[model samples]
Target: MAKIEPGNGLKSAESRKSLRGTTESLALTDGEGNLFGSDSELNVYTSERQTDKYGFIGGAQQYSEQSAENIPPEVLRQREAKWLDMLNNWDKWMAKRHKKMKLRCQKGIPPSLRGRAWLYLSGGKVKREQHKGKFEELDSQAGDPKWVDVIERDLHRQFPFHEMFVARGGHGQQDLYRVLKAYTLHRPEEGYCQAQAPIAAVLLMHMPAEDAFWGLVQICEKYLPGYYSAGLEAIQLDGEILFTLLKRVSPLAHRHLKKHKLDPILYMTEWFMCAFSRTLPWVSVLRVWDMFLCEGVKIIFRVGLVLLKCMLGSQDKLKTCQGQYETMELLKTIDTRYMQEGFLVREILELPVSERDIEKEHLASVRRWKETRGELHCKSLPRMHGAKAIMAAEPPSRQDLRQNPTIIVESPLATKSNGEDKERKNTKEQKNGKKNSSPTPVAAYLEPSEPSPLLKDAALLGSNQSLSSAEYDTYL
Candidate 1:
């Protein structure tokens, strides 16, 4: 793992071998990091060029991308001003007018404010402050040998077309490494998940490393717990819940899937696990994430439902999807028409599924799983949906804090300086010839400490993480 490139270890080798012929041909870089050579039409490269504003190497020119007409300048200015005001009075709005906040999220957070807005919406802002310097510490330490190599292999694979990850070990890739490596250190119990790479890569594109690290943390631990864990238990559970919800969302699609014996995980894993980063177009991905950060997993459910319904809901549409292979093929090649950001968001908003509906289905899914497969080993209860409710949930208990203590290795030089200061103080006392009492010798300074002050007394940013539990009963 000394170098960040395609991994060569046993597992990575096995993985590459398994998918070698199935995937598009891969390309390599010369010693100077220029395009070595490639025969695949999909493999396009040039000698170190710049990326467009959206980060794509060739921009949208190759794709003939068509976007809706831009908003009038006056409208754009009004929207920006409104967003600024909301940011200024964020807490007040969340506490009282969160519905308006949700509406704004659906409309689209301004690109300039998107990163900060994401930090606030995902609770990463609060979590980052609560665990100040933790990312640096985790990144500073060497990762588990097993995870390091796996992570290294996947670094260039994420967003390879984007300029951020185009080079083998550019600053973007280095920061991506730091973020992913920090996660493996932060939660060795969970280790690394390949799916996390694209997710983290997208985050790094929008924010700095530390903020991106915390944003990744909040998504893993709070927004979508167990989705990226060792066994993927939560994602599996959600798959069942999604299938069940499909009956209500689009009975025709549900019946088609049932008849074909297609499992939800089959078509949904890449979409759900990576939050559609891989499946959706870049613009749609951003729009969906905007709603996702504001509304939580329910938004995920809505997007999935919309895709399923639009793809397979009608009798006429189902004509082409005659069998298992054809159906899966259609899902793989989703039309860009179904993916326009404005259209998709509007469909998602109009979808009848509510958060309560999702919760009820979740409970029912758990019951079904218990009846058949025995009990699940989900670590924590599902977190509350959306930003306002998350901000309103009770903070973790003191024991939870203790479990996540930060380990700070003291610098040898600093320790020596402290010892010298103590010695000087003792010498002064002895020279005074008054008491000659020696203070208790200091123990080793290398020890674990609390992550943060816990912010029990202070406001978490402008919002409150200490809102009464009664107000947020859904949170656990």
Candidate 2:
């Protein structure tokens, strides 16, 4: 018998070839050297391997293949040069060209720069730097048993068709588990929500574990606060807001949906909660996400409205759907063929819906929510287990402080109708006894009396300075 030393180098090409042949032969063996499986099994495994290599199995593959083909080289070069400039002079660019940044994002973030762009746009890098080593700490420690099982159950369900999460105990699944588990430990009050799984999965595809985790945090906290809380009041409120917007944008479709007893709750829940990851095609979903990070939650409402119009805008299509089930099926499985990413994004941008429109509706909807269910508080939730005392002692981050600075009320509430002007003038008179008022409407929902601090935080984070009604409106 040959003496085989473990880790000894194969001295020649012939030796390596022999080793390869031996390994291949062993793959066909059943304990001994005889083949154990049928040729069909071997062929099926080989075919799957080929598919994994070349076919678009999931979002990552689909995005890479399609994005490469769709983005012209000249456009890519122009966008890349612009992205480099923005990143190099981030502060200046952000301060001076913020509106221009929104337009660039709407055009579509180049694939090469998307990860870094997203980190900057969501302020994820700042948050990650602030919380260095925190993820590892939470990851090493055992998570609360309460959320462990729930997280585990939903782990495989997210992007299961994707190569990253296809296998049990795969690297992608493990990373997802760690991220979600760490979040539960980080914010035990919110716990784990099913919708967050897909959102995190999408982030993980673009960035590393730590960055992905913080991006998820920014999303839950700043972009759509109260959305994943115990009551899910944000989602419920947004559903009403969506219905209201639908009435304005497409009254016929809205009426058709309403007539069938279909509410935004039934169709728009997953759309808003997961940021359309579950509903839109992966390509369109990525496009939406690119804008969502830069522009905040307004993109979500825009995409939702566009989808509703696509599905139910046409009387012919609406007539084909008989009831709620049929309508939902149509909405859920929209024909991606017609709704190509570029077309859908264009439609969203062209839609006359403005930030002010969404903000006004959101405020009214939130008030309605509070009236029915009392005030919902984010601070009422418990802090992380061991970090509570430290969190109390530690001073707030500059970002956090900036987010909560003294509110500077803008004057002269902007009004479209005489009734609204009268209402605002009366409110202004009651508060300050003034006749002349600013044109921008006061987002009274943002007043301190509201229990959702996260909503206020969102308004602040979206702006460079103190939170004002105008900046708050930009959040949509």
Task: Please name the candidate that would achieve the greatest lDDT relative to the true structure.
Answer: 1
Cα lDDT tens digits, model 2, 297-394, are: 77788888888977898889988798766776787677765457768888888878666777788779768767876776543322111111222334
Query: Candidates' lDDT values, in order?
Result: 0.71, 0.65
Prediction 2 global C-alpha lDDT: 0.65
TM-score of each: 0.74, 0.68
lDDT of 1 by residue, 312-347 (tens): 999998999898878888988787788777788889
- lDDT measured at residue 30 in model 1 versus the true structure, 0 to 100: 32
CA-only RMSD, every prediction: 12.4, 22.4
- After TM-score superposition, the amount by which residue 460's alpha carbon in candidate 2 deviates from its true location, in angstroms, is 44
lDDT of 1 at 472: 25
Residue 423 in model 2: shift from native, Å? 78
Q: Give candidate 2 regions above 4 Å deviation.
A: 1-69, 377-476
Prediction 2 TM-score vs. true: 0.68
